[model samples]
Target: KPFVRRLRGDLLAHGVPRVWLDEAEIDIGDSLIAKIDEGMKLSRYIAVVLSKKSIDAPWVKKELDVAMNREITSGEVVVLPLLYEPCDLPEFLKGKMYADFSKPDEYEAMLAKLLRRLRIT
Candidate 1:
């Protein structure tokens, strides 16, 4: 989750007014599903970090499902895929362009691209 924390920090530093990181947003007694659902609803875009481990996570799948549903219902792009490691992407994400963070040397460039997509700069 270090990557996520760093990403969140960078995003905030780059003028993203609000970022939804579960650890920061959700309290100890909070319901994970409900909080996540609420976060998805409130967010303009959902950034899905794809790594070998996260790809098979059940919670990640569920979150992706929610993000996909939001995209379908709104008829707009809401999911931003961030590839953190080399892994086979889900079928739905195959054709979508992602910000590649796999190569450490390319992080700043990829982050700039992502910010542009986010229309922050």
Candidate 2:
């Protein structure tokens, strides 16, 4: 998974501890809401990998809704999305700034700009 790889890369580069779920065999079905709730509560930053496949993914929607609700309620969580390819950012994340990883130089530039936009390094 590109997302899992990229996230692991970022965490390693930044020396941040992270928990990855893709490798796990745990099932998330009827308890998806509770799982997402826990993930939202545990993670400081939540990234929803948007794509043709992810557009209708229930989990993606849940993640987005959880992040948005958290932002509205607590104003502490951040959604930092890294676009792996060209795709609509959906209405939920439409207005908010997002990173475009379409090209190396361009993505790098956007990364710096986004850092400035988010007031982080």
Candidate 3:
């Protein structure tokens, strides 16, 4: 969660429009699934933080599934994964490349790689 917040801040600082599904952004009556779908539609790329926690999350799986669908249909790189911890990736994600974040010391380098992947300079 901390990494997600930090990444969101970093992207915002870099003038990248990012949509985060954290609790703070949720309204009292907001529909979680609807919000996620809307956000996915608005985003050019979806960054899935593949940590141990996220890997087990159903919501994350759903989001990734949606993103993968977009990628297949549009024939573009829509899902960019950040592997924050060692975990068995989903079958679909196994063949896709991901930015490694397992080594804490290499955070900046990984961030740079992510930005380059996003073509954000």
User: Against the true structure, candidate 3 has what lDDT?
Assistant: 0.84
TM-score of each candidate structure, all chains considered together: 0.97, 0.70, 0.91
lDDT of 1 by residue, 1-121 (tens): 9999999999999999999999999999999889998998889999999999999999999999989988999899999999999999999999899999999999999999999988999
lDDT of each: 0.95, 0.65, 0.84
lDDT string for model 2 (1-121, tens) is: 8655754565445445554454342374637556557666787777666677786788788778778887878776477776767787788777776677666568557656645544456
Ranked by lDDT, the better of candidates 2 and 3 is 3
Model 3 residue-pair collision total: 0
Give per-residue CA lDDT, model 3, range 23-105, as digits (tens): 65668788887877777787898999997789889888888988999999999999998998999898899999999988899
Model number with the top TM-score: 1
TM-score-best of 1 and 2: 1
Candidate 3: stretches off by over 4 Å: none
- Please report the TM-score between candidate 1 and the true structure: 0.97
- Judge candidate 2 at residue 95 and give its lDDT: 79
Clashes of 1: 0
